[model samples]
Target: MELLQLQYFLVVARLEHVTEAARSLHVTQSSLSKTIGRLEEDLGVPLFDRVGRKLRLNEYGNKFLHRAERALFELEQGKQELRDLSSPEQGTLELAVTAASALPHILREFRKKRPHVQFHVQMLATQEMVKLLHQGDVDVCLSSPAVEEEDIECQVVYNDPILVAVPKGHRLAERTSVSLTELKDESFIGVKRGYGTRDLADRICKSVGFEPKYVYEGDEPARLSALVEAEIGIAFIPSTARNSRDQIQYLQVENHELVREIALLWHKRRYISQTALEFREVVADYFKPLT
Candidate 1:
């Protein structure tokens, strides 16, 4: 019923632990419980199902949470709009990306255009980026394996070529291009399963009639090049990731659609300020000539 109650409820629902949520909100556990209880009473239904010390959102809570989140998001947007009115040239743009290879170039371009504007950036997994965008936690997202949600607006920023990376002296290192089928039996170093690059590589490998056998599965895309250089495994490396590393050779994948389309995404319903719009333009322009 109260704004404070709604805020407390949202934290509890997200964490699913009363103690942790209370600690995060810097409130006493008993007080948080009382607030949630009052909210449930006001609504005439329990928002959560209790199982020992843990909590889970019930059907009614699930339905209400979406609306609750939207209400808070809109209110926060209104507050941001007011703040922007006072300081139009300076504001923090919250951004999320799946990879960091192309980020620096885009950010440098953006900063040149809007030196007064600041950025708060997070490198997240593809799925986590989607969740943050939907929750209105981040202003914009640069993602791969682009999202297809109904309320999300996704635009292709660039189609980065994915190549096979091999050690300097490997048999295929002398080649300019190689097919996925040729590397079918070779061990690979790959990004984790949920990653966009990994998904694309897996799909391509499967199309070639085999799944990539990864000897090293890592979270960092930058490290894959080193892993390949050590003869640990070959890997599918994006063109943006080829940051002047001399120990490895990058070969184009022959007769295959070995490209990852990086997309810029944002929620359609979330408010966009001038600062955010400028950054978006900077991003689009950064990739324009390359495409």
Candidate 2:
């Protein structure tokens, strides 16, 4: 019945491993187990089903978890609201993004306007960004993939075209544009499968009747450009990724609608502080002219 018990149970339910959950909670395994046992006794029902050393949430636990998560989320939002009310200008803004390509400009403008506001930024995968947004861990997310959750508000900040990048002396460097089919025999350097750009590139390639053959798969989008510069492989780079690097050529994809939409997302129900609201405004204004 205690708040600590609910917190511990939520962690255990998420990890499904008592030892790992106890470690994460910074408590002894026996203490965590005893607390869970007491919680079950007080509820008059077992919340978890024992599966070897792992704990799986039972039907009752599954039903309770949703409410438990909401309770914590509400408490956190209330805390943030109080902090905002007390010191509107000075607070931390938790932000997550898929990549850092568009961050410097946006953050620079935001910081210039709200110099007292601090920022905690995380470069997360598309799925991780969505997960944090749902958990109320992040105030906002800047991502390429459009989030379609009902509880979330997603606004398209920028629509950047995806360009095929090649080395300066490569055969395709002189071309202004080329079709996806033309690169069927070309090797590519791409972000891993879970990345938004990588997924888009894969889908577009599949639509053209051939899967892209990758010479390397990595998590860093910046490294993909470096690989292309080294003549290792060509890559699909976003327009935002364009910089002063002269070693590479970015060509448009011919007859293909290959574009990535950068979205600014926030939880609709979560309390938004003045600082967060200003940050959102800064982002909107930053992209206003681009649209």
User: Judged by lDDT, which candidate is best?
Assistant: 2
Write model 1 residue lDDT over 164-252, tens digit each, in one string.
88999999989999988899889999889888988988998898799988899978887887788789989888898885778788899
The TM-score measured for candidate 1 stands at 0.86
Residue pairs that clash (backbone atoms under 3 angstroms), model 1: none
lDDT of each: 0.88, 0.89
Task: Give the TM-scores of the predictions, in the order they appear.
Answer: 0.86, 0.87
Report the Cα lDDT for residue 110, model 1.
90
- Residue-wise lDDT of candidate 2 within 1-291, one digit each (tens)? 898889999999999999999899999999999999999999999999998769999999999899999898788888888988998768889999885687899999998988988799998888898999987889988888878889999988889899999999999889989999999999999888878888998998999899999989987787887788889999999988877789988899999899988888998998987887888898889878878
Model 1: weakest 10-residue lDDT segment is 240-249
Show model 1 residue runs off by greater than 4 Å: 12-21, 33-68
- RMSD values for the candidates in order, in angstroms, are 2.9, 2.6
Clashes of 1: 0
